[model samples]
Structure formats: C-alpha cells, structure tokens
Target chain A: MYICLMYSKEIVKGTLKPIVLKLLKEHGRMYGYEITQNVKALTEGKIQITEGALYPLLHKLQAEGVLQTESEKMGKRVRKYYKLSQSGEAVADDLISEMLDFMQTLKSVLNPDYGQA
Target chain B: MYICLMYSKEIVKGTLKPIVLKLLKEHGRMYGYEITQNVKALTEGKIQITEGALYPLLHKLQAEGVLQTESEKMGKRVRKYYKLSQSGEAVADDLISEMLDFMQTLKSVLNPDYGQA
Candidate 1:
C-alpha cells in the first residue's frame, strides 16, 4: 500500500522520449514496434510499455525537433523509424545526468532518516 | 560534443510531474511556486525546472485526477496546494518501480559490453 500510490504511467509516457531518443542517438535509428520490443526485452517483461504510450511520445518527440523519423516498407504496413536530431543528441546527455541527480535527491527526501550525511 | 545531444528539457518538462506527484504523494499538500523552488534546491541548479513548465504540468496532473488542489491566502496572492488523490497515490508507486526498471534496461543497452553478466 505504501508503494502502491507513488507513480504514474502517464508521467512515464511523457518522459519516455528522452530514453528512446538517447538510445537512438547512439544506435543511429530504431522502429516503433522495435522500440517497444527492445524495451520489453531489456526489462524482461517487468517494464512493459504499451504501443499506445510509445507512439504518441515518439510522434510528439518528432514534432518537437528532438527526433527525426523516416519510413520503410515492411510487408503491408510501413514501419516508421526515428533518430535524434543534432539538438536532440545534446538534450539526451543532459537528461540522463539530470535524471540521475533527480533520483538521488528523491531517494534522500523519501528516506531522510537514513539518507542523512 | 558527444554529450551535447542526449537530453531535452522539453522532454524533461513533460515528465516532471510524475516525479513531482511522487514527491507530493509522500509529502502531502505542497504549493505551486514552492514546487519549482524545491526542485531547484534539490538538484543544485543542475535540474533547475522553471515555473512555466511546472505550473502547466501541475495543472494537468490536477485535471487528470492524479492531484487535488486547494487555495490559501498568502500576502497579496493566493497559493494553491496539491495532494494525491486515491487513484493518484496508486499511480505514483507504479511509476517509480517502472522507471527504476527502465533506468537499468537503458544502462545495459547503452553500455552493452560491461552491461552483460
């Protein structure tokens, strides 16, 4: 119960782009379904992200100039792939660092007694 | 140069609320502007989140029923305090666990060689 009311997928959805963009920035490019599959494989099913959440974040990231998308013919449906823009690459690095710091700060606040210096 | 394009504040802005909500879920009621100041203080300016980004996120969180708000008189202006709803509390816990797992998966893929067992 203590942990039950602590986080939201909507918030996760909002932030997933930096995670995806950062990965793509290093790997060059990746596809929609592929991105979802990769995340699932990496987390081993503990952190399953639905297509509904991912696609919208991808679209929004692409629209925000932080991500670039290209299309490829894949059987019947066209597969859309995404990569980071020059600006996006810069942003991803900053994001990872900031998030790391943010996590620490949260840990300290949430466990202040033991978290003390 | 390589790190220049790894993160985007806009993307960060979108996800700030889940973190904020998680904090609020633990802290109970907190103010609008106070939220921004606290995040800044916590991150040591490395994660200086602006009021523009925070207020919108807070408003949206409130709208989504992940947050509840009440107004209080403060000098010349009224300050709004936000807390988690029954549903919002449940969401925060899930978000934190999911995000933690995500961070680990991301670390592995980004650093594949050392990441392997």
Candidate 2:
C-alpha cells in the first residue's frame, strides 16, 4: 500500500532545528509538549516532531549554549520550558535567513524558470 | 570575523540529491562535472556541489536504483553520465512535490504571519 505523506521524513529531519528555533522566535519560551503541539497544529499534523528527535536536539542546543531552560513544578513532575539565549537569537536569525535563501535556490533548481538561470 | 555565505553547508547538504535529480529531470542525462557546472551556473555560484559530496550521493542513489549511469571513454579517461531510472523519475517527482510542500511548511514555521496560523 502506498501511503501518501504531506512531507518526507528526510525533508522533515533536515529542517527540524530551524522549525524549533523559529517557533520559539515567534512565541517566546515554550515547554517541550507545547512545542510539539504548536508544530502539530501549525502544520496541521503534517509535521510531527517525535520526542526522540526533539528532546535530543533541545539538549544539544542547550549544551551548545544556544538555548536556555527553566523548570517549574507541575504536580509530581518538573515541566521544563525552553527559550533561545541571546546567542541563540542571533543564530536563529542567521539560520532563518540562510534557510529562506536556500529555499529560493532550491526553487530555482527545481523550476529554473523561476530564476534568472 | 563572520563571513557571510550564500547558503550554509548544512542546507546544501540536505538538498543536494533533490537538486541533482531535478536538474536531470530538466536537462536529461548529465555527467559528473557537467552536473557540478550546471548547479554552479544555475545557482550563480551560490550552491557549489563538491566532488566529495556529489559522487557519494550519485553512487548511493545508483545503488538504491533511483539513478542509472552510462560511461563513455573520453580519450585518456572514462566519463560517466547519470539520469533518473524509470523508477527514479517517479521518485524524483515525489521528492520534488514533497520538497516543495516541505518548503511551504518551513516557510510557515519561519514566518507564521504568512500562514493561516
């Protein structure tokens, strides 16, 4: 059976980080679950960030000093909220710019009529 | 000193296969150097495909039956050409659609104002 997906896993994999960063840029300080829900709702379930993928990337971004986190007591568990650090804000801006430019380039490559090439 | 690049290596890395596939779809069979030059010209030198990256991807796609290659003797050396296989055409079409959709999703993520979100 051929199952149609709105987007491919490969495309999703490459863009996950930027998606997270941009969401945080738009809506400041989001908890992990909030991030997931926000993305799900925003993309209409076309783009779901698995916990396996999201947490590690969050951790890595934190480790790289690009992200900051704070925890609040939520009943028996601590709920962590994440936000971009100042450096992360800069990184996000740079990445967003790069991503947009890359999209234009890819569009040109796919549809040469769209470009001067 | 921060040197601005037209696109990041990471973005280029992820899109390379689709770029190659799309070019072949537009221009028919192409050899390795020709592919590189076509990308260079098309992207206006913004997206250069390094041999180290391009060859491995070509070989991998060939192995996966997504691409077919034909080699011709060029005097002292043999020149190899690549095109989408019959199945590869379908794959390329699917990927191009997915990539375009993913680009829209990514644009929405980056610029929520543009989306219904």
Candidate 3:
C-alpha cells in the first residue's frame, strides 16, 4: 500500500471514486487485485492504489448500492469482482461528464488567455 | 456564495486552493472580489467561489507563509491584494505543476485507451 509518485496523496484521493468508476465502465468488471494491477499498468506505476485505501472504498461503494459484486472460488479464498449497478451506471456517466467539464474549466483557470475577460 | 452548477460542491472544493494560486501566478496580484469575479468570468459562471470558502483559504495560506498581502485604501475601505511571497513563488510553481500533472493523470484514468497497458 505505497504511493510512490510526484503527485500528492490528497489530490489523488479526490479522484479515486471517479477513477474506479471509469475503470469499471471500460473493463466491464474487475476484481480488487485486478483493479490495483490495472491502475498500476495504466498509470505506468505513477499512481498506485493501496489495499488500505481500495478495499474500504470498494466495500463502501457496495454498501451504498453503487457497486454490485459477484464471488467466485479461486483456490480456497473467494474473489469478489465489482461492477456498477443500474442506478450506478447513470451516476457514473453523470460524474464522468461533470469531471470532464470541470477539467475544461480548470484548464481555463490555469491558462487565462483562453479564459476571456 | 452560491455554486449553481452541475459540478458537485466537493469536487469544486478540492481545486479552490490550486485555482487561487494559479490565478495569483497569472494575474500577479488580486483582491478577494477580483478573484471571485475573474473565476466567474473565466468559467462563464459555471463555477463561482463563495466569500465563505475563499477568505478562510486565503487566511490559511497567508498564515502558512505561502502568500503575502498588501493593503490599499479605496476611500473609506481598505482592499487587501494577495500575491505569492518569495518562498510562495516557489510553492506556487510547485503546486501549479503538480496540479497540471495530476490533471493529466486523471485524464489517463478516465480514458483507458490512452492510458496504455
């Protein structure tokens, strides 16, 4: 559960939920370990989600009905895979769109030449 | 201090500090009201910073030695303009760079195709 990167932890924390939702949207369904590995691979080891951080959020999302899980037997331990629920699909699209729009606004704030008066 | 937009309050809250720092970096120095007006105009009113949120952060940054303030009199009222201090300039650059990098990473997370395997 180590985050070895140039970015600060707080900033990464804010986007975790959205990142997970986006990954699930693209991948269909993913187990906890698969999620961690994919994030590492996707960011090229720049951003690593710790089990300490990931599991609680996954459980919380499941509790909130935003995520639905299915369990399968692997060896002896059960592997829980997560995907978005019906309502969660709508929530994910809305959140992703809002995040994209917010990013555009942030770009405008950073580069005032495009920001107009 | 109304944030009447599609974006959630929590999402906007996370970026306020960086947004303020980027503005001070771009505009040189700005007063509280001016900062709010610029953000409103820049985002085309999609994002607005409330006095309640802005003042506390300004004070906190000032206390942390990341910002220095100048007071100018406008008739009966004194307006305080904030700019980065000597050390603050460094901090501002660092924060701005980190924010931009984080945005790129967020984009990668949102779009898996560009994220590479």
Could you tell me the lDDT of residue A79 within candidate 3?
A: 93
What are the per-residue Cα lDDT tens digits for candidate 2 across B1-117? 223445667766578878889988987899989999989988778888899989999999999999999999989999999999999999998888777777767787787675334
lDDT of 1 by residue, A1-117 (tens): 223222345534544655676568667999988887776676565446678878888888788998898898979989888988889888676675555544445445444454335
lDDT of candidate 3 over A5-48, digit per residue (tens): 64677567577778888899888899999999998888877788
Backbone clash count for every predicted candidate, in the order shown: 19, 0, 0
Docking outcome class, model 1? incorrect
DockQ of each: 0.21, 0.53, 0.41
Chain B alone, TM-score of each model?
A: 0.80, 0.89, 0.89
Give per-residue lDDT, candidate 3, residue A54: 92
State candidate 1's DockQ: 0.21
Q: Score candidate 1 by TM-score against the native.
A: 0.57
> How does residue B37 of candidate 1 score in lDDT?
74
For model 2, the stretches where C-alpha displacement exceeds 4 angstroms are: A1-4, A115-117, B1-4, B115-117
Model 2: DockQ score: 0.53
lDDT of 3 by residue, B1-117 (tens): 223354677567578888899889888999999999999987878888999999999999999999999999999999999999989988887776777677777776786465333
> Who wins the TM-score comparison?
2
